[model samples]
Target: MTKRIVVLGVSGSGKSLIGKSIADTLGYPFFDGDDFHSQANVDKMRQGTPLNDDDRKGWLATLNAILTDNPSAVIACSGLKPEYRAMLRNGLDDVTMIYLKGSIDTIWQRHQKRDGHYFNGREMLESQFATLVEPTEDEALVIDISQNADAVLKEALTLLANSPTH
Candidate 1:
């Protein structure tokens, strides 16, 4: 059976990298949530402005539609708040929520070196951390971001394989 996977985390937590890797391994398509954000939203993040719930409603809806369209996909998104996660979960079957859990310092340090991204360094990261509602034990398959990208991907795939879905 095809599974819908959401690779979620704060910025710099390797959502895009890990999600894409997992997608390739699973022979699924990858969708980066950043690419679907509205220009206004992008501008706000570019300016280090944190987006409120109202600002994300449309964006989440659009991403939810993508999940609906593709049964098996690896989607990299910052599913920060509970409401946002719920919205993403709406009308989905076989959905796997993968939360890339990481320490603020670890992510912040990594964010500093990243270039050509709209998300500003520490400021944007602080906003994301402040708004994050960490996924609970039942809500997601959590993985530590302290691990290397290859290890993280392997761990994720192992978890998926061992799951009842198989």
Candidate 2:
């Protein structure tokens, strides 16, 4: 069966990096959710303004469409809220989520060191943390981003390989 994985976290948690590695290891196409956003959305975020639900509404629909149409892809999305995740999984099954968690300090440092990104590292951090609703008690494998990328990928791969759905 085709499997879909959502790599979720606040900005700078290495969701994009780790998600790419995971998808590559699993031989699945990888998508960075940021690339899916429209220019307007990007512009808004670039201005250090948080997007309201209305701004996200159509974007979520597009993500849903991608997930539905491409059954074999792994998507790296912030998916900051449960509602957003629900939207992504609207009609899908055999989907797994991996939360790449890191402390505020760690993420802050990473974001500060990051170059060429549109977002203001400081402002977006709070908004992302505020909107974040961690995975449910019964759902998802949470991986701490305290270690190197290699170790994190190994752990995530082990779970994917051993999972019943996989």
* Backbone steric clashes in candidate 1, count: 0
| lDDT tens digits by residue: candidate 1, 59-107 | 9999899999997888899999888998998887677888999999999
> Which residue runs of candidate 2 sit more than 4 Å off their true CA positions?
164-166
lDDT of each: 0.88, 0.83
Please name the candidate that would achieve the greatest TM-score relative to the true structure. Answer: 1
Instruction: Candidate 1: list runs displaced more than 4 Å.
Output: none
Q: What is the lDDT of candidate 1?
A: 0.88
TM per model? 0.96, 0.93
lDDT of 2 by residue, 1-166 (tens): 3378888888889988999998898888898888888899899999999887888888888877887888787888888888888887888877788888888888998898889987775878988888888885356778888999899999888877766532
* Sequence-dependent TM-score of model 2: 0.93
